[model samples]
Target: MNLLFSNDKRGDYPQSWYAASADLLAPFAPLGGVQRADVCVVGGGYTGLSAALHLAEAGLDVVLLEAHRVGFGASGRNGGQLGSGQRLDQLKLEKMLGAEDARRMWEFGEEAKALVRGLVERHGIDCHLRDGVGWAGSSAGSVAELHDYAAHMDARYGYGLEVLDREAFAALCRSPDFQGGVLDMGAAHLHPLRLALGLAEACVRAGVRIYERSHVHHIQHGSKVVVQTDAGRVEADHLILGCNGYLGGLDRKVAARVMPINNFIVATEPLGDRAAEVLTRDVALCDDRFVVNYWKLSDDKRLLFGGGESYGYRFPSDIRAVVRKPLAQIYPHLADVKLEYAWGGTLAITMKRLPHLARVAPNVLSASGYSGHGVGNAVQAGKLMAEAVRGQASGFDAFAALPTPAFPGGAGLRTPLLALAMSWFALRDKLGL
Candidate 1:
């Protein structure tokens, strides 16, 4: 089954808290006839929208096609935490790509956050952007390691982080599972769907032709790339694949390197004053679990908790139940609380847990496999692709130079293989290994 059509209704967003609470824009019409543009961007998440917006601003005729609505994918349904750095820590990156490249990567990651903030401010996208992300250690050893990493980032890059001891962390998080934690003041959180819809509005204002519900089924690669949807087509000078997890057989090379996975989240009933009893602060929180659990209080004081993953095509029938177990693990008092909303989203990951940016063809660029750091990475990837299309490719080349290995069984068998590997890691996490 195609991930684009799996688990969710065609041409509809999931019944997510983000969707319910967002000021969603009126749906853009699907593409219905042949069109020509300077660039055709497939997939209407952050990457496509941002790229289209930037390109249009640069006086390029841009067409962005989305299977359903803009931001209807992981961009609208994620944890909404825009944390510091890439999916892999910078220290690990130093060893993998050497200090120079790693340092450049870190700088790019930092600039990604700045880009998001600048976009929001300049375009007036009111997505409740807030700073401070908490990194709680799952174990004492994990806690110590987090502390050391905090120091490392602060010393190396002058990144600001407040390391909290056990008592202070407990006062802020009120979680027995979370002892001491580090608060990255530079990181941020926001209403993801609002940000996406806001960007779509900005794109339209910037002259981007956005076609919603226009699913791309085939692509003809050449000097003039042709993108085919059921009732419409786009011929453009450049093509960008921002499909991420929803990409299905669009490009074989990208498919081999990027694997899609499902994640679930739930929002609890408004906690009122009890919100302070649970989390004394407004910081977004995440732990060091192999399958990480992240949570924060919504503007209305509801607890928005994201956890659980499945190595399958379908989301669990009862997403609420699937997430409740982990919610109990972190906050027992909220275990039986009323679930206001529960939803699942698909996101892609690379073998090394870093984003994969590649020039799949001379004029066709693809960016995906952001792991859990898409909020910042996706937007930056979009801007870099926009730059590359204008013949300024140094930034894009830097990202493309990072190695992205194909999965052992490629895309077809990766599901089963990933299932086995994730099960092993989950078991190790249970055993605290």
Candidate 2:
């Protein structure tokens, strides 16, 4: 099945409140003929743009090809919660990779967050960058777990988190649904599309050649790699495949290690004073559930609620309908609010619940499987990939050393197996198991 074209046609940016408020920018031209550069990056989202910007700044000629426009992928459509650490817990990482390596990973995440803030300031990217994020508990058990986790972070990692009890949590969020939660000031939220567009512009300023609508059809790997697109080609000493979940069939081996999962989001009409009633703090909100509910109030006061997932490539016909129930479950007061927009994007996941970063072939590096935690990690991945290409590779090698198991079934049956596995997890969530 040609999942890419099908999803591409169906995946129009659904009247998002962000899109409505963002400043208009000029479009990039598509690739037309053969070209050459020191590096060719596929997928022009945060990862690609970051890599391109860093490489170009280092005086390496860089060519970035995007199938659509920059930020058209998950980079633009995400919930904009820039949280710390990977998708998996730090304790889990410590257990899996040892304490020393896990500490390095944690520091890397902090650096990623710092890098984002620095870029925003350096480029004057006005994307509504805000401090702090809330991890609210969906149940009593989850509340206890959150408190314990907070204590763990404080004791083991010297991280400070404001732990709130039920009453205090309700006061902080103005929602009766949450039992309690932890607020980490280190994490944050922002207008993701704006940030991505700013990065693309910065890359151009740094002399990176960016081409939109340039879908790479094939990659001929050798001493120097040659990437072929329908209208153009790029020969480079290094190639960085940052396509993530939308990779399509670019490389079968790399594709098999990451499964594409579809996640959807909805935006409600500006609630004005009513928004403040629901969320006292403007911090981004996320729940402690298997199918987590993540949301935040936009600069314009519209609530950007994100939830719902499909393991297969197909998206729900009525995204709002799929998400409304979950939204209501969290804040019943907003049940009647008019949904202004709905959209969906794909994120890659691995069986081990860790990012898959490795060299698929000689001189060909790929990084994906961030799961739903790409905001900070993807940027770091791009920077690390650039460093690797420049011969300083210890940081990138650390990620490449992480074990990532491919789907049990090969490409043909992988989708079905993943659907079943995710369905089971959703069922467990429903049963509170």
Candidate 3:
């Protein structure tokens, strides 16, 4: 399958509600000729921009190249849930990599949230940041599990969480589908595209050079790395690859470590009084299932519903049709609501459901495979990459040390195998497994 990035230009912005709502305020020229910098970062999304900001602040001459406009990929199209921690549960992480490492990982997630908050305030980014996120249970069994999970977090990690009964949760969400859930104050939701744009602006203000529409086609690595774009080239002491699922053949090793999965979302027409009756609070709500339904009310009172995943490279012909069922399953009243816009974005996934961070070569680093949890982890990965390049490799090494196995059957057969495996999980979700 041709990579998503290899396809023809899909236009600057998708018809998602976020793009329609948020104000994009920055514009940068594309790379025109050969340039030299202390660090050359590829992909102008959150990861690349964050790395550029940190490196430039450290006095490194940083140059960032994006294939399209900044935040044109998943960074602009995500559900905007600033979720806490890695994709795996804390206990699961502890079991996988000892308690000491798990605690440090948890701390890193905390720092990620704090970093986002600090950048928003320090850079004066108007991304509509808010607190509190609810994890709605899809079934009674999941409700019990959430309650247990909440209790464990409070007991072991001392993380404050409110466990809501079915009645309380239904009152909060105004949905009968969920039995109960947990409300975590630490997690949050925000305007993702705005945040991405803000980071790009911040990078520029920090004296980092940004080149838009400069797709990196090749790289020559040695003591110093040289990145070649379609129209220009960049020579730098270090190179950072931040393109997630849209990453093409720029680096085959990092590309093979992740499987690109396409996900879609839909935004409903403004509900006015009807929206108020649907959600008691403005907090984002995500269900507990393999293929979870995550929704939140936009500041404009539109319902931004996100769900549905595809292992194939091509997006579904009718994205709304593929997402409507899941949206209705959560909010049956919304079955009649008019969907204003629908769009899809691709994300990278790993077999162990963990992010893949590693060094492809000396002075060359790459991080992807955030799965469905890129909002926070991606930013953290960029910060860690900066630290590694600055010679403080302890934290970065911890994550880079995590084992990332290659996809089975190589790239040729990986997508089909992933589709087959994901189908079993989707079936389990339907059976309430």
* Number of the top-ranking candidate, with TM-score as the measure: 1
TM-score of each model, paired residue for residue: 0.99, 0.97, 0.97
Worst 10 contiguous positions by lDDT, candidate 1: 328-337
**Please, what are the lDDT tens digits per residue for candidate 3 over residues 1-433?**
4454533363367777888887875557779888999999998778888889999999999999987788988888898888887888888899998988888888888888988888889999999899988899878888998899889888888898889999999789988788899998899899999999999888988999998878788899899898997789999999999988977787788878888888899999999999976798989989987887898998989898999998776788889999999988778877889998999988788877788988889899988988878889888889989999999988778888776789998978998998888899999989876
Clashing pairs in 2: none
**How many clashes (backbone atoms < 3 Å, residues ≥3 apart in a chain or on different chains) does model 1 have?**
0
Model 2, position 10: C-alpha lDDT score? 31
lDDT of 2 by residue, 1-433 (tens): 5455556643234356666677746777888878988899998888888888889999999999988778878888889988898788788999998999888888888898999999899999999999989999968988998899899999989999899999989998877678999999989999998988899989999999998878888999899999998888999989999999888888888888988888989999889989886688879989887878899898778889999898776788899999998898888888889998888888888888788888887798888888888889888899989999999899899898888987888988998987887788888877878
Candidate 3 residue pairs that clash: none
Tens-digit lDDT string for candidate 1 (1-433): 7899989899999999999999888889999989999999998999999899999999999999999999999999999999888889888999999988889999898999999999999999989999989999877888888889888888987887898888889989977877788998789999999999999999999999999999999999999999999998999999999999999899989989999999999999999988986788788998888888899999999999999899768999999999998899889877668998999999999999989999999999999999999999999999999999999999999989898899997656888999898988888887889
- Residue 396, candidate 2: Cα error in Å is 0.5
Error of 3 at 104 (Å): 1.5
